[model samples]
Target: MNAEIIGIGSELLLGQIVNTDAQFISEQLSTLGIDVFWHTVVGDNRKRIMEALRLAADRSDIIITTGGLGPTMDDLSKETMAEFLGMELEIHEPSLNRIQSYFTTMGREMTDNNKKQALFPKEAIVLKNDNGTAPGAIIEKNDRIHIILPGPPSELQPMFVNEVKPYLAGKTVDEIYSRVLRIFGVGESSVEAKIKDLLQKQSNPTIAPLAGAGEVKMRITAKAASRQEAEKMIVPVQKDIESRLGNAVYGYDDDPMEMIVIKSLREKEMYLALAESCTGGHVTDLITNIPGASDVLLESCVTYSNEAKVKRLGVSEDTLKKYGAVSSQTAYEMAEGIRKISGADIGAAITGIAGPGGATRQKPVGLIYLSLSSYGGTETKELHLSGNRLRIKEAAALHLLNWLRLSLE
Candidate 1:
């Protein structure tokens, strides 16, 4: 079935808040074999919302609206939708009881205006909101379905998954599954060049490539009667692609490179330390951000200054004085130093000229050196990434971690 997501908030159109609900809804719908053709975001105005609703209803089988479900004057989603559908708004007794019980449990006074949350379109299916006071609802008219959810993601997400999903699941046919292979150290153009034939001939299972700062993600989606069938369909293609470019594909299906590196290190009984310069410790930040990383991550040295490199990671003054900080020699020494000092099984370093400044004629900005030091291996590679300071920093981090993933394997 075709669906449309309509996010009702001025903040979305004004770019104050991103419309994450549409993204969540689109992912969920794809799993249920529903194609979302349009994503509409309308302000908290009655006329505009009504126009959006009317447009969505005319073309889409299922219309999902998120936001503006609050107890305020600007919260006009339910009231406007009721008016548009020529339906009356009535207070749901169970919802009213839930709200009252909640306020009483907190020992707080329930104002009259709070009762507005209990109002729903007449004869609508009440969507219980366990996380918030604003309960959502589902209504069907003229063979078209309307699902209105609370504005807060905490409320809308759970209500959609637990209460609303089952209702919608029964009405759909077939199942769809998608797997994404995230590749680093490879340009999107090169990846496309290698897989252009497969992409061009795509039919039941669609292949799409998405390019970002310094990496490309290839998504393969298939439709089948069950998820197992879809996964089975993907296995052969996944194997073929892996065989061709196993060195570049770091992780699969929403797995970040840092997570893969961490997990691989755990499997190998290895610990890691980082000496970051261009990435400004973002590599350490990503690794430490994961839960239980303390078990494997010993220490991280952000030696942005030449003095810090010399003192913290034990880089020799002569090496820095000769080859400079952004050189591969400095990166190698930094990795070896951090590994020895921290007693970690592995040390990774990223030293680069990530800049709007500080680049020579031979070494331009975005020139990065990633080094890995391990018992059986010592490797260093250079990368030239593009973008502003933040992008260069982020890309440099991802590149170093992905290279660590390769070394671990």
Candidate 2:
């Protein structure tokens, strides 16, 4: 079934709050095999809400709305929906009792206007809100279903999970499942070119490529009678894409580079040390952000200057003098030095000129050298990237992490 999510609040339009409810609802609906075609955000104004409802009802089989179910005067969602659907609003006695009991249990006085939370359309099915005072409703008219949910995620999420999901599950026959393949070291264009044929002839399982910060995400979605069946359909397509992309496809679904790297390090029972230059401690920071980092990360040093590199990471002064700090020789020395000093199983280093400045006659900005040292040997890579300083730094960090992940594998 096709669905449209309408976020009803002036705060969303005013940028006071993000419309995360729409994202959550869309994800939930997608798993139920409901296609979310549109997301409409309307202010608390009645006319605009009515117009949005009209548009959604015309094109969508299911319309889900969030927000404006509160005690204040501006809370107009229920009243507007009732008026638009030409239904009479009546107090649901059980809901009214529950709201009163909630206030009483909290040692707060219940005002008369708070009773407004219990008001629902006569023909509607009331949804219990255990987390908040605003009770939601589901209205069915002329083959269209309107689901009204609270604005607060804490209240809305539980209500939907407990009350709405089963209701929708009974109506849907097919289930949709998706997997996101994360790729690094390859540009979005290259990824698209590699998968162009699959995209052109896509049908049952659709492939969508989304470019992220310093990475690309390929989301493959499939629909079947069950989630397992849907995932089974995606496996061959995913393998085809992976075979074409090769090692550039790093991880799957919600796996970030750092998480995968740390997990790999832990699995191999290897400890790592890092020596960072132009990226400062960003690579280290990313590694430490993952849980259980201490199990695998021994230490990290931010050797920003030539003096620091020589003093801290034991880089040879003669090498720095001959090839400069951003060279492959210095990177290899730094990686080996850190590994030896920390007694780690592996060492990684990144030296680069990530800049709006610091470009010389021979060396340009975004010139990066990455090195990894292990018992196997030491390896180095040269990269010429382009972007602002922050982007270059982030991209450099991502590249190093991907290298570490591949090495571990």
Candidate 3:
């Protein structure tokens, strides 16, 4: 069934608060095979809310609203909805009792205005709020269903999960399942080009490509009676995409590049050390953020200055003078030196000129060199990236981590 979410609060339009409720409800509805066609945000004004309700009723089978269920004078969702639906607002005694009990348990006095929260449309299914005073409701008129939920996430989330999900599940016949494939070292356009044929011939499952800061993601979605059947339908498509993309596709879903690298290191029983320049220990920070990182990471040194490079990482002063700090030779020496000094199985180094300054005629800003030193051999890569200093640093760190991930494979 097609649904529309109406976020009723002036704070959303004024940018005072983010409408995270829409995102949460959309995701939950997707699992029930309900397509969210639109999201409408209106202020607490009764006229605007009534207009939004009229529009939602015309185009959507189910209308879910959040916010404006409170004791304040401006709370208007229930009143506006009742007026539009030609229904009478009546006191739900059970809900009133719950609200009174909540205030009593908290050792607070119940005001008369708080009773406004217990009012609902006649013949509406009252949804109990365990966390707050505002009780929600489900009103069915004609063929359209209107679900009113509280604004606070703490109250809305539980009410939806405990009350609304079961109600919607009974009406749905199919489930929508999605899987995300994470890709690095490839742009969004290139990924789309590789999967052009799959996109053209897609039927049951759909393929969508989304680009992030330094990575691309392909989401595969399928609809079936059961999740197992959906998985069966998605396997061949996933195999095709993986075969085409090869190793550029690093991990899946929520696996970050550093997590993948740490996992690979743990599996191979290898320890690593890092020597960072313009990245300023960002790569090391990413690695340490993951749990169990101590098992794989031996040491990390931020050798920013030429003196530190030479003294801490054992990078040769002669190499720095001859090839410059951002050169491949300096990167190689730094990696070899760190591996030797820390006694790690592998050492990775990043040297870059990620700045609005420090550019020569030949070496411009965003020029980066990455090197890896291992027992087998030493490997280095040069990248010419373009962006602000922060973007350049992030992209350079991601590239170095991806290189390490591929080497471990």
Each candidate's root-mean-square deviation in Å? 1.8, 3.0, 3.1
lDDT-based ranking? 2, 3, 1
lDDT scores in order: 0.89, 0.95, 0.94
Please give, for residues 1-409, the per-residue lDDT of candidate 2 as tens digits: 9999999999999999999999999988989999999999999999999999999989999999999999999999999999989999999999999999999999999999999999998899999999889999999998999999999999999999999989999999999999999999899999999999999999989999999999999999999999999999999999999999999999998889999999999888999999999999999999999889999999999999999998998999999999999899999999999999999999999999998898896789999999999988999999999999999999999999988988888
Give the per-residue lDDT of model 3 (tens digit) for 39-133. Answer: 99999999999999999999999999999999999999989989999999989999999999999999999999999999988789999999999
Worst 10 residues of 3 by lDDT: 226-235
Task: Point out where model 3 deviates above 4 Å.
Answer: 86-136, 151-163
Off by over 4 Å in 2: 88-118, 122-135, 305-311, 316-324
- Candidate 1 structure, TM-score to reference: 0.95
Which segments of model 1 are wrong by more than 4 Å?
101-109
Best-first order by TM-score: 1, 2, 3
Which candidate would rank higher by lDDT, 1 or 2? 2
TM per candidate comes to: 0.95, 0.88, 0.87
Return whichever of 1 and 3 wins on TM-score.
1
Q: Is candidate 2 or candidate 3 better by TM-score?
A: 2
